[model samples]
Target: MNVILITACPSGMATTFLGARRLEQAAKRLGWQVSVEMHGELEAVTPVSAEAIAAAELVVVAAERVPEPQRFDGKRLFRAPIHQALPDPDAFLERAAREAATFDAASANAGAPATATPAPQAAGGNGQRRIVAVTACPTGVAHTFMAAEALAQAGKAMGHAIHVETQGSVGAQNALTADDIAAADVVVLACDIEVDDTRFAGKPIYRTSTGAALKQPKQTLETALVDAQVESSGAPQGGSAGAGGGARKSVKERGLYKHLLTGVSFMLPMVVAGGLCIALSFVFGIKAFEQEGTLAAALMQIGGGTAFKLMVPVLAGYIAYSIADRPGIAPGMIGGMLASTLGAGFIGGILAGFLAGYSASAVTRYVKLPASVESLKPILIIPLLASLFTGLVMIYVVGTPVAAILAGLTQFLNNMGSTNAVLLGLLLGAMMCFDMGGPVNKAAYTFGVGLLSTETYMPMAAIMAAGMVPPIAMGIATLLARGKFSQPEREAGKASFVLGLCFITEGAIPFAAKDPLRVIPLAMIGGAVTGALSMWFGIKLMAPHGGLFVLLIPNAVNMALLYLVAIAAGSLVTGVGYALLKRGESELPAVADAGSGAVAREQRTG
Candidate 1:
């Protein structure tokens, strides 16, 4: 019999191709001619031809999510879980053939794209176990797919049925079904960012990073099989994996920081995009918004009007998401809108997010409902109650106080002439580098960006200058003291300089994560110097962000030459400081540890 198999997963890595090879071998051994197609995130997929589809007697789909499946409308099809086709591929193929169902061409092709009718749950009745996993990374590229492959391979070797869902940059490939989660003995979450994990509510879950899974897949699987927890509906095992290993820190201790960072991470892109667009508008002169039908006006509308407006609501919504997953989005956004209306700025957005997040979480945790209407908790009750609670608090209690403080801060910054401005710049600069993109860094950024609405631009200028120092400084340091950095880090430094010029504070994250104690203090000192010089020179920037690149726009920065001088001075100081201070050989691993859990190792090195 002629057979065709498609192996597709997010990240389209080893998980897809490796499984395809195994499945092809299994089919060949079963005396059937088989062809396989591989779909991966990074690699180009070889499309299965229409001729191949038409000639096939049977098609087996072993994937977490198949992007398009309508082609097999008239064929006998089998939807097998990922793990089924790996180790004992012969058995899996035989079983799939026995269970394959013929599709009605007209009926299947009539409506929405034909979807795979999931096969009945594997009973694990043949002395095999069942497992399900979700693998993800911040970039959702290599590690995410590799981890899925590792787990699948290990599980197959152990004669266990495994299905891995990959969350990659392109999107989720093989999405887990409710039945898969239900029948699984355990759920493995090998990810570096927050996932929609609430789906695994009552399931036994084993949590770790993608790196951990790649390194020790067998251990991860073995541990999951034995020590997984039946998670609560309220919070996932570790409160949203904050930056680095900091997630392990108690919510009571770093919860505010973690949740705030989550909001900041989501909010920053809007700030950067809006800020640059607004800066671009300045090319048509400062009052470009007043002009109609001009590129300047368009930029203003996009930068100042749309993205800026959405920034606060998005911030609040994601913060709530971090706290209470998807259920918190609506309430948090509403709360943020109220905060903006009340003139509360970023602070208000933050408050609204936390309030909405906690309130939504509380509803999910405490507001028990009948099993018949339990679905209403996430859909109706949590959002409704959280929105109400957050809205009320933001409008009444939080808004007034926060607005007053923001107003005071804005007034104070406005009144500063030279010395006061310099001091403030120094503090803001120090804060920017102290934690690289952490709470303190974002706090200063938020304050500076918050003042854009009030037409106060110097603080933002100072903040940006300070923020740029860390990455540029580290990059310069790497060039000057190559021996202090590993080969890969030196390459990273070249990239850091470019990112630094673009005002991406995250470029310094790797250096800071490697040796916070040595790197951070030096960064802070340099940033402070840059910030103070920008303010003392009375230099003002009209744009909220965008480093050197924004200077290309006319009138974006008031003293472009002086601004460059300040950045150079700061970079030199930081580079010289590192050259003088950093002791011993570079401890940077040959392979950069990109995992969030790597922070614990950084702590040890420090």
Candidate 2:
């Protein structure tokens, strides 16, 4: 019988991939024809097809995130917990096979959709129904999109038409449309913050935390819609709507960097704006050497002060936006502007924005309401509350450390020299491999950019060279020594080239995270050696983002030939050592780690 399985997790990188591998082994052992797909970044393999789903006698979902609730409308489904799939793969396979022996395809087809209110829920094939949803988190970083993708991808794996919207640091992506909303049998809002528009007013609405969507989208979505039906059918109920009440769910304890991610997401635009404005002023405005005239000075000042001023508000506003949605827009902008005026710049602006938003949210949540309260959310409540918080933070919190850090970082860069440059290189390179794009990586990167002002460009070159080595070497070694890594990892070699040039050190993280003993130390030694060598050789580069590709760009690097040597040395060590220690399917189960889904996914498509 044809079978399709969906694999997903919070990160969709390692756990999902690992799960897919487990499922594959399970399917192979049973001699079952199975197809698998992921709910993550890489394009899906053997994506679920209508014919495939129709032909399947059973559908197995190995996931953390749930797809749309209706995908399994008329199918025999058994969801294997990702944990079970990852560790005791053989046991889960046996369990699923035993359960599949009991599928009642005929009865499922005869029933109405698993869930859906009669009034607004649209009917699907053989009385199946579909739910459409949007998932978001405060930082717009990990959970927000993972929730959405898991639902959509999982739903599809279950044979449902699922569309997703992601509220990420880049803003709303995969945006849901009016058509999408209208066609949905039901709408689910899985988020931490307030999403815009109450357009699904008459639709059977389901509101849940992102975790609910990830782990139990189908159950939750079904309850939400069916509960609405019970309510509409005159079932006596509490005054609240759906499973919740007028009060919003406060999502606490998400991750260490969630709030900070929101602040940074909000702050980036301000930097872009201010940086561009200042850069432009440096370009077209009066040069200090060209003119001493007052009008020339005025033009320069306006460019620097005017367009640049908008930066803070946008930064703060977006950070607030990331957290509270539309409500965050006003206070965030105002607080950001206040921060700039108070001499805080972007850092202060971010603090002011977050403070304004959280306080404004608290004020909005409590402080008893009158009939005018609805209007006050926009007209009065937000501004009054945001302004007070912004004012306080700017005067005290935002102004102090924000100002000092900015000053200190700038001073550090300005004074970097030939003697210190080599040390700086080692630091940046090591950081690049430590966590890839994490906070440590950011600090090192930010420092490199900081050095641009001081005209000390070598640290960036070392960073660039070091960053590219791990992924590239890891990729080459896998290709050169296929027997050392698992079948799943060998497949990942397909994407490693692109990651290598882009300098995404985390490309190697899946292997490293899972097999740190064999992988990390070797990779680190390689990285450290490369970083030190690049600096000692005085390889210099501009541009903080690009990797070896930058050398091809005109005049991007100094001592370009030596840069290649430095990169090659690191890459070789990382590649050879990683291959030697890489794990096979048997080895994977031995490593117990957090975020099981990520490990699974990385095994398949890392």
- Highest-scoring model, TM-score: 1
Per-candidate Cα lDDT values, in order, are 0.73, 0.61
Give the range of the ten consecutive residues with the poorest summed lDDT in model 2.
240-249
In model 1, where do residues sit more than 4 Å from their true spots?
1-193, 199-254, 368-381, 482-492, 504-517, 540-546, 582-606
Q: What is the lDDT of residue 439 in candidate 2?
A: 53
**In model 1, which range of ten residues has the least summed lDDT?**
113-122
Question: Using Cα atoms with residue i matched to residue i, what is each candidate's TM-score against the true structure?
Answer: 0.59, 0.55
Candidate 2 runs further than 4 Å off:
1-155, 158-161, 166-174, 177-246, 249-256, 266-313, 338-346, 366-377, 396-401, 416-431, 434-469, 485-488, 503-569, 583-606
Clashes of each: 8, 24
Clashing pairs in 1: 11-41, 12-40, 12-41, 64-174, 64-175, 65-173, 65-174, 65-175
For each candidate, C-alpha RMSD in Å? Answer: 19.3, 10.8
